[model samples]
Target: MSKYLISIIGPTAIGKTALSIKLAQHFNTEIISADSRQFFKEMQIGTAAPTQAELAQAKHHFIHHKSVQDQYNVGAFERDALLCLDELFKNHNIVIMVGGSGLYVDAVTKGLDDFPDVDESIRKTLNQDLETKGLEHLQKQLEMLDPKSYGTIAIDNPHRVIRALEICIGTGKPYSSYLNKKNTNRPFKTITIGLHAERAIIYDRINQRVDMMVEEGLIDEVKALLPYQHLNALNTVGYKELFNYFSGAWTLDFAISEIKKNSRRFAKRQLTWFKKQEEAIWFDYLTPVDAIIKKVHSTINAEN
Candidate 1:
């Protein structure tokens, strides 16, 4: 019997979590989250992580499993996630993986691209530049050095931008040049499902979600994490926007509006990355769960 990994991917607030839980329950399996932002234990409300009720409905792995102070990266996540999948596969032939982070999702489904290790000093210098010159400076550098990566990666993310710049400076090669070079074969087959909607609807959903987060104490959550706002994990959309407001750089209303705008942009980038997966089966955001299940079953049967 071949094992199967049902991967649920889509833009933020696109109902991936709900669909993943439904599929996991139907298959009597567990879920592995690939959302990088949801990994931090302190970032629950802002990340819109699974609620207590939703988590109780299905056994989930990798949610709130690490702290912002930890030095975790996608490479480490790939190794750990594969180990978790190995254990789960022994108990059930099917497992579910869900997230809006394209890089993390690809890390599990396809192996990460190999890059040569550069001197630690290179990263140190990049961090120094980020502190002195700001993320915009580094982003501009990447746009000049590796436009392809700049377009695909989360450009607004300082960690992502710095990672790309370090690679480019360390190896004297475009960061995009190192991607998609590895074709690792895994033990189980992957069944990717992407949920999508019209641009206006997606934007509206994101705006409403942001407003709900604020109502649910997102401001208080950000305030609690103010001490660790410098951590890479805290450099996310929801947190960073509020951080600006706390610094008196922007009004609360303006901060909330920025969060919505940034979130919508993040969703657009997510869609751009996920759409590149030509093998994925896409469905409307409102598609019936039963219909999707039938499609999954047929796909599995046909392959067998």
Candidate 2:
């Protein structure tokens, strides 16, 4: 049997975890999580990481395996996940890669595009602009510099917007110009499966997930990590909202509402990002496990 990487991708709160676990257990293989938010050990409730029972059902990697203080990025994850995959293929012909982080999954399947080294000064200036002039100013700047990226990338994410703006300003080109380059070939074949639901359903699920996170002590988790809230990894949806509450910028209720709203927006961005995966085969969120498993088996056999 040939080595195969089955990637389960979808928006947050879209049931990708359960589906991935089912597929992994069915294949008697392990799972590699590609969700960037769930990478930190300190962030459990906010990132919606799998429960202990979920982890025990099948072996998993890249969940809570890093510290928020560490400088982990997609490039590093690509290297690490590939090394992990190399080891897994030694014993199993099939492995599961699952997450909603489009870049991370693409790094393993198609590889990241190599961009020119951006100057530190450019980044510093952009950060300064973000701090002083607000994200709106930088967003407009990106719109003028790289409208394509401004359209496709998650512009609300300050880090993502800043990264794209820096590349555009430093390279004197649109950031999109550097994407979709020939992918680095991998030894194993990747079959991407996407999950989707009606927009209303996705939003409702996101709202409910945020409520569940709050009930699960996400506020306390943020409070415990208050000292390290300045870290880049901590600048995410759930934590950031609560951090604002701690700073007296927002009330607890307002903060929770923001988390829900931002989470819904994030899910929308995820759907937009995954749509760019041209090879992905999308399934309804409620699609039966047997049907998906059959599809996966056929894909593997066809590839072989």
Candidate 2 ranges beyond 4 A from true positions: none
The residue-by-residue lDDT of candidate 2 on 1-304, one tens digit each, is 7789999999999999999899999999999999998999999999999999999998999999999999999999999999999999999999999998888888999999988898999999999999999999999999999887876776767999999999999999998899878579999988999999999999999999999988999989999999998788988889989999999999999999998898888888788888988899999999999999999989887866
The per-residue C-alpha lDDT of model 1 at residue 220 equals 99
Q: Whole-model Cα lDDT per candidate?
A: 0.95, 0.92
In model 1, which residue pairs have backbone atoms overlapping below 3 Å? Answer: none
Top candidate (lDDT): 1
Stretches of model 1 off by over 4 angstroms after superposition: 119-121
Candidate 1, residues 24-75: lDDT per residue as tens digits?
9999999999999999999999999999999999999999999999999999
The TM-scores, one per candidate, come to 0.97, 0.97
